[model samples]
Target: MPRAVTLIRSTALSDVAEYAYAATAPADARLIFLAGACPLNEDGSTAAVGDYAGQAAKAVENMRTALGAAGAGLDDVISTRVLVASARQEDLVTAWKVVRNAFGDHDVPSTLLGVTVLGYADQLVEIEGVAAVLDS
Candidate 1:
């Protein structure tokens, strides 16, 4: 069996998200599209308020849960899209740190965007991912 890898590249966007991603897998392979995940707790309440680090952590955790639901893990994640409410340099840096820490040794192709706002007024960050199920 052959494994597929995600591709990342520098883009014209801000320094935070220069990496662009594409899905490249066998035609017969199974692919999963995860919905946009926000920094919300299990109880459907916002996890962090005005805390970039905390919101980032929760967003990453939510991404992990989404991947698991698709029968995949962080290692199987091919691409990720991160949305940050604040475009401040400091906030971007802090969010990146949280994401990098969550991935640890597994680094997948990712894109980070600085947005003016998110779905929830308290949400500071949102994360979405794509994964591929391994062949049995």
Candidate 2:
């Protein structure tokens, strides 16, 4: 059976389909909380410095890897938190699109954050994910 994930959509919110406000997951589902996914390449180097879109893409790829390690996929995602440095909404929008592409039709709850700096030098975007895995 599929995991019971209910998305509450409202017309009151623009971009509601882009991300839900609330998601209800099956009680029997296994929840996975990931550490913030970084845009580090295989060699632990920042994939792209000062490039919000590239960093977001790399971070989303890492999140997908993280989900696979836990026996889940993008469809299992319940929510995501995206952080972009340099305190610009434009940066957040650019990164958000990358995240949206990664999530595809899932469209679960999400947050875009703007910050002055991140944990790593040359890092501009970070993504954290929450997922649920239900019985097959």
The local lDDT score (0 to 100) that residue 26 gets in candidate 2 is: 75
Candidate 1 local lDDT, 1-136, one digit each (tens): 3455454455654555333445455566678888887899888889988899999999888888887777677766778778888869789778978986787655667777899988976998888877776668
Q: Please report how far candidate 2 places residue 92 from its true position, in Å.
A: 1.0
RMSD of each: 3.6, 1.6
TM-score of each: 0.81, 0.92
Off by over 4 Å in 1: 1-3, 6-23
RMSD of 2: 1.6
Error of 1 at 52 (Å): 0.8
Q: Which residue ranges in model 2 land beyond 4 Å of their true spot?
A: 12-17
* Candidate that would win on TM-score: 2
Residue 59 deviation, candidate 2, in Å? 0.2
lDDT of 2: 0.85
